[model samples]
Target: MGMAVVTLVLAIPLLAALGLVLVPGYRTPARLNIAASAATFLASLTLFVVEPAATKWFVLDAFNIYLIALTAFVGLTTSLFSAGYIAHEIRIGKLKPLQLRFYHAMYQAFLFTMLLALSANNLGVMWVAVEGATLTTVLMVSLYRTAAGIEAAWKYFILCGVGIALALFGTILMYMAAQPVMGPGMAAMTWTELMVRMPEVNPKVLNLAFVFLLIGYGTKVGLAPLHAWLPDAHAEGPTPISAVLSGLLLNVAIYAVLRFKMLLAANGAAIAPGPLMVAMGLGSLLLAGFMLYRRRDIKRFFAYSSIEHMGIITFAFGMGGPLANFAGLLHMAMHSLTKSAIFYAVGHATQIKGTQRMDAIRGLTVSHPALGWGLLAGVVAIAGLPPFGIFMSEFLLVTSTFARQPLLALPLAAGILIAFGALVLRVQQICFGAPDGVSKAVPVAWSLLPLYAHLGLVLVAGVWIPGPLVAWFQTVAALLG
Candidate 1:
């Protein structure tokens, strides 16, 4: 049953991507996409009940199991959101049916790659999976074929291409680090074996490999100085894709880094990866917060928010303690839910306003109360306001930092405040005041279900975390050290 569940989780998407290529037209493909995503998500849930069938090529444990479920859940919700989003695009001729066929295929391919990356036991296979994820997203980002879209896709390709190259060198170095101790071959490259044997591996090679790994995966995480590709990709690509990029892809990259971090933690001689990660995380947070005040495109604006939050998550994990790591895990989940919900709202708003420009998108509350208020709620939650999951996570992170590293807490607090003010200021301009452009009523209430569902979960999580889940997170945190 365990093997069956895992096979189902992977096979559904791979088969669906193939079947979708032949299943033409708007309605059927959209339904098929949702159905496939739903099946995969259901299979992912079974991972908790069924024993994970860990093998040489694949691994499932306390960590990746949670992420696999997350990836599938978000994939399902995004597909649900995509049904209406893509239909609207087709109605307006922004996308052709042919393009959507390719888009759906690539979407499944992206999911398959992400799941593969999370589940892989082998370092080389994980690298290939991550690279595959980049390729699939690049094709989708260029779906419109417009010059700007193509430019964004190419820019994404080239920048992340460099990142992947650095990562490959790092993976080789990791293998080199393990070869002498483990005596080479697949056992040396496997994550489970490496974890069992890592303390014996040389620390210098581990430190050197991590530098390349951090920057390489860090590019995908949208950490500043390496985040050029993010905003453009979000602004030019379809909104559903933007949601997954922020919600799932960034999490996947960080997941990769965390895996490597664990190996480093095992060796006493490896440089403390904490300071370098902390520096990168803080820099990204500050850069994104200030940049938010300048964005004209709504998607780009939220894209910057993603960078800011990723910084916080990275910082929390870099702090390296039980409390901080737990906070980081919570923030990653909250940010994924909140940011994706915001993109979903932004997608709807742009469709109603006939533009993505903030100036042209005023009075959303007056024009479309559901969307306007939904956007406002998402922004509040994301900005770390009270009674939402983000508030709890950020508060824990800030308090933990203050308790241990007082000076670092000040910069983190400043970054949060800077971003908070920018979000509140901007959301008011967009949601209130007089109506701006086109104000046609959204015909479907069903489309807002994912938005409400996500925000509600975030709300529930703020005040209470179930005990079993808390135990699970605590276990993962201790494992990180």
Candidate 2:
């Protein structure tokens, strides 16, 4: 039953993509897209009830089950948001009907690749899936065919392409390390098999492999120095694509890194992966915090916010204690929901106001009360304000760091404050002050349901986490260590 669920989850998107290409017109495909995504999400939810199991090609476990479910949920919600969003674009003549067909098709394809990456048991397959996701999104990022959009797409491709290549080399090294113990074959590349025999694997080879993997996968995670591709892609791409990039793709990359980190931990002789992750995480957090203050494009500003939050989650996981690991997991969930909600609101605001410029978008509350308040709530949640899940997770991370390493806590807190101040300032300017731009009201739709639902979850989780969920996180936290 579990395997069937897995197969169905993977198949829905692939089948939908094929059908979408053949289907004529926008409405049918858009509706079909949402239905397919909803089906996939339902399939993913079943994994929570099933026992952890593995096939020769895939595995289901605590670590990935929640992530898969979250990815599916977000994918479905984003598709709902896209229906209204793309319809608006088509009406305005910004996107042709043919482009809408292509967009729906690629959206399913993108979802397929991400689910494949998360579910794959073979390290090589996971890498291929991540690469496929990059390729699919590169096309989407360039969908506008504007010079700027094309440029962003090319940068995304070149940078991530190079990074994935490095990751491939690292995978080869891992296989070589495992060959001596597990013998040369598919088994040597199997994640489950590798984990069982990791202690006997060559320490030197594993250490070097980890370095490459960290740098390689870290690039995809939008860690600094390798993150040049991220902002441009987010700014240029469709809003739904931006949400997926930040919410799903980055998490998948981090999941890959965490898998490799587990391998290193299994081998006592290998160098500790924590310090490297810590350094990179801190670098991304501090860099993004400062960068946030300078963003003129609203989407780009949120893009930087994604980087900052990714850094925090990375830092928490790098800390490696049970408490820290749990915090990291919670933060990942909160950031994904909150960031995507913000992007949803931003998408509508930009369309209504006919601009992405923050300076031009003022007094949103007066202009569009629902959207303005929605954006405000999203910003507040993302900025780690109280009564939101992000704040709870961030608090856990900060306290954990202070208890374990006082010096590290200083920079962590500083980065959080820096980002917090910048986001609050920008949001206040946009939501308050004199009313400006687009006084005409846009029709409200069910699409906004996702934004509110996400915020609601964040709010509820902050105040009261269910016991079962806490237990699940604790189990995963132990596995992480």
- Candidate 1 ranges with C-alpha deviation above 4 Å: 51-53, 441-443
Residue-by-residue lDDT tens digits, candidate 1, 8-123: 88899999988888877879888889999999999999898766556788888778888899899999999999999999988888888878767888889899999989988889
Clashing pairs in 1: none
- lDDT of every predicted structure (CA atoms): 0.92, 0.93
Residue 379, candidate 1: C-alpha displacement in angstroms: 0.6
Clashes of each: 0, 0
**TM-scores for all predictions:** 0.98, 0.99
* Model 2 alpha-carbon miss at residue 238, Å: 0.9
Off by over 4 Å in 2: none
In the range 29-55, model 2's lDDT, one tens digit per residue, is 999999999999998999999989898
The pairs that clash in candidate 2 are none
